[model samples]
Target: MEFSWLETRWARPFYLAFVFCLALGLLQTIKLYLRRQRLLRDLRAFPTPPTHWFLGHQKFIQDDNMEKLEEIIEKYPRAFPFWIGPFQAFFYIYDPDYAKTFLSRTDPKSQYLQKFLPPLIGKGLLALDGPKWFQHRCLLTPGFHFNILKAYIEVMAHSVKTMLDKWEKICSTQDTSLEVYEHINLMSLDIIMKCAFSKETNCQTNSTHDPYVKAIFELSKIIFHRLYSFLYHSDIIFKLSPQGYRFQKLSRVLNQYTDAIIQERKKSLQAGVKQNNTQKRKYQDFLDIVLSAKDENGSSFSDTDVHSEVSMFLLGGHDSLAASISWILYCLALNPEHQERCREEVRGILGDGCSITWDQLDEMSYTTMCIKETCRLIPAVPSIFRDLSKPLTFPDGCTLPAGITVVLSIWGLHHNPAVWKNPKVFDPLRFSQENSDQRHPYAYLPFSAGSRNCIGQQFAMVQLKVTIALILLHFRVTPDPTRPPTFSSHFILKPKNGMYLQLKKLSEC
Candidate 1:
């Protein structure tokens, strides 16, 4: 009876299909094993921490543990192989010389970022490479010119003042410490909306339930989760997962919001609203610049292109700035002397005026030093990644082949004792012109270095100076001991819990 069942035509086809599937699986396994072996052979020169055979180094290195990272950095010296799984690893570069060598190359960004971020940011400057990147960069460069940035100072000041007013109310009404990250995040969003979208949004004063704001936060969490969870790395698997579905829904929300704004701007432009050259130069925002921009071929950015850049700016502009400004405040709170010194410098520059000017921004030398030191200690974007496009040799004669992934640990570089004495100390003087000149140029990379550096760094600096100076002028910030901040390194380095601080209203302002 069994022999007769096996002889059936349908049974023969089913058996063949099963055998084929088995063969395919075996082939994939063999291929992966060979690739892993090749990678191990290539990376044999670099030191690496002990890794599990199956789990790799995921157990040893975690996002929360800075001490363990420091130990690894010390043991590995210049660079090390950080294995994510049996078949995946990155050549982690922390040495200034290694960073300088790799960053100067025309290497593309990591393949993982290219795979993951395009779904959200849609091949914006942060995601694009080579010719397309060059074209978009040229077109958008004028949007951040000094003249354009100068016009944004007033808008930034107004946003900061609104935040201060809220802080004043809270300090007067209650005796409790305030979690400042949320407030600063909202304020930064408010500034980005006015300056980038040319729209005024009372994000700081309003509730945080707005769809755009909520979507950004949730989507970031999902993307960061996907990056670390190896199984979710596959588009097919991720799309079928619950988080993936949520990502699609939230992405639509963000796109719809931006598309609406772009359409409104287009309608206004079509209606022939005109401005004189001087007026346009003084008042044009990022939206205006990109909308009217034309390339060498007299081509304007497609709606998709504009949408991508806007989404990139909206997320990059506000979230990172909020982290930076909040951390700067936290550092200053911990070191009262530095805080007082920065406060006095701002006072000297502004006198009784609360409004900051473009010229006065330069005069806050001490404050700038504090800001730099804060960024060095707690960089907003802690790690930068690149995929080598060609074989590269480092200063120490170490070599990595093309197609290898390299991670530049800005946190490790900043904390490396070889680069800075007493790396953990909050010393603003470390950034003084004399001391800064003595250090390696790539040793401190808050906005990264090279052509792929943060495009909005100048704009971020202006906002930082304006917000910090104004806040210092009005309120004296003190750390809350009961709620000391814990560090979390997700997409951005931020307080794990929240940045809680006591704000005492100052009579000076």
Candidate 2:
């Protein structure tokens, strides 16, 4: 039937090439199967929930609610298998010992989760691994030192005051009730702009807003939306999808904004050099430090590198702090007794509506406890995902092979019954000096633990303490009975509805 084509001498070579391609594909499949078999034998020792042949545990994740997810963790007790597809699986870990064992190792962040962020942050400190991460971390460490942070207090206070003033104006006018989360988010963004770029955003007072602020916010939503969609996981498919288009557009907005800031900072630095003005300023912001930083090779960071780090600082500084402060205020609003206690502590330290000094910040012990408890209840970054760079051994004698994915569930660890007496109780006393000394260090990881713990923990804590202090000084926060916020988990544990709280003047309360 194909005699016309087969008669040609080239037919044999074409047929041979087709067979070779098919053979190569079969060999690749065999290699992958062998690897999975070896890993699966080890993985089977750890308990897993029922999984489908094709879908695996994806159905569970798709239909996931906090309660159901928690139940699965509880049932597993230590770790569980979550297969992404036939080829990918993660050992989801919640047990403190297991988490600590894994976290202590400097594993690369899982590409699956980290991939969603590179468009926004580039290959910044958060996304980087190995020597690059170590080098960047060392260079940026001095920037967040206590002395440097102290120099930025006025900047932080200015942002917080702007937010408070806006709230005061709102309270004085018709709206006594307000959404606290969005206001705090704006305030955090304003602080990050000033702290990272040494630029005034005026987000609190300005009627017109920076496009970057809105774009970054929308970018986060788009990222998580794509993450859960599953089909969008493939870069090729995602780029063609509508969500991908929106992501690309928002990413461009953020990248352009970041690039502009870096360029302006570079020109300023050059002008300083040309003018022979080498005298160090009282404080150096994140951009200043990044520009000044030199690698072991004595080369300064590229504009791309500076851009990535700046993006990281902005995102990590803004959203995480906003989530923490918002949740703390929400917790305080719910428990008026604790709120009053915190207020009393603040009043004792700083009198009536006085500025929060660095020294005075340390004096608000009860208020600090409340913040700790809030973090314990709702860690800003709920879970951390990592790719096992080397084999990991747990206390149970079960070992996971390299190339496996590991999820360190910060939420699960905080809520583990074995660690806390009543995991759900809103008791600040859990963090009191005597009580804190009693628990495992890994048991409470709001900012995470080990080698990869948050670089900005101190910075975040100071902001939280200052904001809480100022709010307590002037106003009494109470929960809105009619519109209580519901808790949900995304990248950050968030209020599904906006966090609505009622504020009354201190004297009136």
Model 1: number of backbone collisions: 0
In model 2, residue pairs whose N, Cα or C atoms come closer than 3 Å (at least 3 residues apart or on different chains), thus clashing, are none
The number of the candidate with the highest TM-score is 1
Best by lDDT: 1
User: In candidate 2, what are the lDDT values of residues 159-235, reduced to their tens digit?
Assistant: 88888877777788543788888888889889988888778767767733558767866787777766655567789
- lDDT for model 1, on a 0 to 1 scale? 0.86
Off by over 4 Å in 1: 1-7, 60-63, 274-282
**Which stretch of 10 consecutive residues in model 2 shows the poorest summed lDDT?**
273-282
lDDT of 1 by residue, 354-409 (tens): 66799999999999999999999999988988899988999878889888999999
TM-score of each: 0.95, 0.89
Q: What is the lDDT of residue 173 in candidate 1?
A: 61
Collision pairs in model 1: none
Report how far residue 466 has shifted in candidate 1, in Å. 0.4
